[model samples]
Target chain A: MQPVYEVHKLSKYYGRIRALDHLDLALAPGKLVGLLGPNGSGKTTLIKIGAGLLTPDQGSVLIGGMAPGPATKAIVSYLPDRMALPTEMTTKDVVSMYSDFFADFDRVKAQEMLRDLHLSDSQRIGSMSKGTQEKVQLCLVMSRAAKLYLLDEPLGGVDPAAREYILSTILRNYSEDSAVLFSTHLISDIEKVLDEVAILRQGKLLLHDSVDHLRQEKGMSVDEFFKEVFRC
Target chain B: MNWNITAGRPVYVQLIEQLELAIVTGEYPPGSRIPAVRELAAEAGVNPNTMQRALQDLESRGLLQSQRTSGRIVSANQDTLHTLRVQRAEVYVADFLRQMHKLGYTQEETLELLQKATFPTVSNTKEES
Candidate 1:
């Protein structure tokens, strides 16, 4: 099957620093892929380029047969590491805003999720805790039935309980036709959900394959293999 | 369910292997109810759907059985676990030997590392602890 998102020879630079260096990535439909990397490994830079939030200095990124334009944006649901919602907006307001912007946004699913979590719609974003705000952000992103979901650091910097909630939300909301690419340094936590993984180091692609293939061939955990491969 | 996956294998398979190991190790014994998918998922810091896939796979393999209201339970027999463990151990040994060869460890040197590793003698007094 053709890849939903095909990134070829993609390279990005931050002045003199190369954030993404000739990175090639492909995503199949319904795949939940983990993007693993150390700090400054260009995971975010790749996601930003995929989200159209940043432009590549060289190379190309295609989402759903087009560049990262409105056409691709319509089908891609992107969650940045930080919450981008307005602090002044209420939870309901955020839901309403998403409903208005993305026609594919499932209002009922959003409401049902809120009900499941017992979160009050009346709660204002500014008053909620960071973890709670993350829940709200997750609800809005997952509620959309996008073709591709780019979750940058979905499990990063969150409490253990909150991490569980976020990962579950992604799994439950994503459909079989949709592809989810999540990037984080917290490998052990999110490693279970990832059907495939792409390990990045120093802005280079070190490995990419089904987790089973790696384990069966090497007879080691991804974490141990990572430590050994990237050992100084 | 709250397993922090330490395996190098695919997540779903690693998940199944871990659960199988738990059952074999009597962590979740035969006929005993295991954590609900959501509960285990929440505990292990993983996605419920991912955990669900592992549970379903194990259930089909007869390593686990899932009931409607009671959640999942360990399968009665553990022959599957024993078979898998033996296969994995062989792979681990092969890789270990390969690495030892790559690291230029002679047969005697490798045996020494193994003995020092397996049976810490008086010479193993590294006082670090």
Candidate 2:
């Protein structure tokens, strides 16, 4: 089977800074992979490239066996690090927009999730708390039956309870034939949910392996290993 | 059921242990159809692939049986389940004995304590304290 996401000799640079240096990564279907790194470690850069928001300077990035393009974008649901929804739009309006734009969007599922999260459909995005807005964004992205989910910092800036909800929602909503790639520095919180982990440092891919294998081989949790590897 | 998945241990191993316990305890009763891998993974908050590995391990051990159309089901063999239960209990007993030994208790003392714990009525006066 083709990998859900694949990057081959991918390189990207920002002026004098190297954002990603010949990075090679692949995410297979039916796996939840943790893309782990500290700040400015090119995690966001790699996500952007996979999401087709930024084109790589060299090499190739593929989503579901195809290069990043409109076709791939249709099958990839990306939740960026920031709030990208229109603040003035009501929650229901946003759902409608997604339904209109993405053929794969399931409005019923989105509305059900919103209800479960206690989000009023008529509430304006601008009026909701940052965490709530993030929830809405997540609902929108996950409601789609996409083949690949690129979640960048989905757990950032949220309370622990909300983080748990988001993680479960991602797990429950994503299709089994698809894959989810989530990047975060909160290793301890997310490690239990991860099947594989890809560790990045200074624009370089440091390690990528099954989480269970890492623990068995190192005799330490992912968080501990991460601290040891990136210790100052 | 709430599974306590501790860090520093391989999650797939923990997952297998937990699932086995559930099976032996009848949380997933004998001959009952188990939930699909993805559903269980989501409920346990682990990855689908990890859950699949754990389930496959159980299938290999004959604790679970999978059919092409109906998915996975717990083993209906009463003999296998009884043996599994005894084996699991032995593990606990061994661990308890090790702990007692660490506390400087002799094997005889440990057996006496176990006897008292098992037959509380006989040691009710001591337990009152």
Candidate 3:
């Protein structure tokens, strides 16, 4: 099967600083891949490239065999690290907007998830707390039956219970024909749920392997192995 | 079943171990249909793909069988179950013997210690029975 997302010798620079340095990564469908790295290791940059928010300085990224463009965007569901929803819009409005923007959006599933999260449809985005907004955004993103999911920092700033809820939601939406690339710093919480992990260091692809193979080879949890690899 | 997945090992390997334990203990009795992969994955709080891999491994081992009508059922073969039980026991006994060796106790000494040891709860259960 072709990789749902592919990057080859990808590089990006911010003036003089290199955000990504010749990174090569490919994500197969049916796998939940954890994009792990310390801050400034180019995790967000990589994800942004995949989401087509920013073009890479060099190399290529393919989403479903096409470059990140209108065609790929139609099939990619992205949850940005920060809140992108307008504060004035109510949850219902956002659901409608998403449904209009993406044909694959599942409004019913999104509403169901919002209700389960105790987020009323009438609640305005701006009035809700940061964590709630993130949850809402995640609900909207995961509710889409996209071919690829690019979730950047989905676990950031959420309480432990919310984190558990988010993980469960991801697991529940998992499909063999699609893939989820979740980038976050919280390795311990999500490592067990990942099929594979791709670790970056200093804008380089440090390692990528199945979680179990990593553990069996390193004799340590993904968290411990990451710490060991990134230890200063 | 309470699925406890610890760190430092492969998730599927742990799932296989736990699922085997569930089967051998009759928690998933022989010939009983098992839960769907998604259900098991959600219950264990692990990835569905990982759970499916573990289940496939068990199926290949003859501990589980897939029927056209039923999704997956625990193997009803007593011989297979007995062999698996004996295999698990041998692993435990090997580990015990290795530990005794590390403590400078010979096999005879370990057996003697085992014979001499008594558990109040086990003794009470025996008396009650």
Candidate 4:
């Protein structure tokens, strides 16, 4: 089967700074891969390239055998690391917008998840707490029945309780028919839910291996292995 | 059930051990159907694929059986269940002995300590006379 997301010798640059340097990675369907890297390591760059928001300077990124384009964009669900939703929009309005934009969007699932979180339809995005906004974004992102999900820092800035809720939501929504590549710094918190990890260093692919394989081979959890690899 | 996954160890290995414990303790009794992989994975807060791996491992060990119509079920064989229970207990026994050895307790000393101990109470009430 074709990989849900594939990158081959992908390189991107910001002027002289190398954002992605000869990086190669592939995500298979039915897997939740954690993309790990420290500051300026090109995690967001890689995600944006996969989301078709940015073009690579060299090499290629293919979403389900096609390059990231209008075709790939139709089947890709992206959640930017920062707040990207219109603040003036109410929760109900955002749900309606997603439903209108994505043919695969499940409005009922999004509304049910929002209700479960006690986020009312009338609540405006700008008025909600930072954590609530993150939850709202996640609810919409996961509600889509996309082929591949590119989530940048989905767990950032959320409290521990909210983090658990977010993780559970991800687990519940994940299916063997789709793939999710999520980038985050909270490794230990999200470690258990990941099938594999792709670690990057200075825009280079450091390592990509199954989480259990890493633990069995290195005799440490993925978080520990990640720390040992990137330790100062 | 509380998964109690720890760092350093492989999560799926922990999952396998916990699922084995659940089977041996009758939490998932003999011949009883188990929840779907997604449901169990969500409950444990781990990936569905990892949970599927753990369940498949149990199936390989004869502790679980997957049926075409009823989903996965705990093994109905009493002998297999009993042996599994004994094996799990022996692991704890071996660990206890190893710890006692680290503390410089001889086998005889450890045996005597076991004799004087009352489990479930978790307190050493034997008076030194």
Best by lDDT: 3
lDDT of 1 by residue, B85-106 (tens): 7766787899999999999998
lDDT of 3 by residue, A1-232 (tens): 9999999999999999999999899999999999999999999999899899999999989999998899999999999999999899999999999999999999999999999989989999999999999999999999999999999999998999888888988888888889999999999988888999999988999999998788888888899988887888
Q: For candidate 3, lDDT tens digit of each residue in B87-125? A: 888988999899889999988898899999975687788
Q: Candidate 2 or 3, higher TM-score? A: 2
DockQ scores of the candidates = 0.18, 0.61, 0.57, 0.68
Per-model clash counts, in order, read 7, 0, 0, 0
Share of native interface contacts recovered by each model: 0.31, 0.69, 0.64, 0.82
* Per-residue lDDT of model 2, residues A70-186, tens digit only: 999999999999999999999999999999989999999999888988999999999999989999999999999999999999999888877888888887775668989999989
The best candidate by TM-score is 2
Q: How many backbone clashes does candidate 1 have?
A: 7
Error of model 3, residue A60, in angstroms: 1.7
The order by descending TM-score is: 2, 4, 3, 1
For each candidate, the alpha-carbon lDDT, in order, equals 0.80, 0.89, 0.91, 0.90
Question: What TM-score does model 3 score on chain A?
Answer: 0.98
Q: Show where candidate 4 strays beyond 4 Å.
A: B104-116, B119-129
Deviation of model 3 at A215, angstroms:
2.8
Model number with the top DockQ: 4
Task: Please give, for residues A1-232, the per-residue lDDT of candidate 4 as tens digits.
Answer: 7899999999999999999999999999999999999989999999999899899999988999998888998899999998888999999999999999899999999999988888889998999988889889989998999999999998898878777888888888888878999999999988999999999999999899998888889888787887888889
Docking class of 4: medium
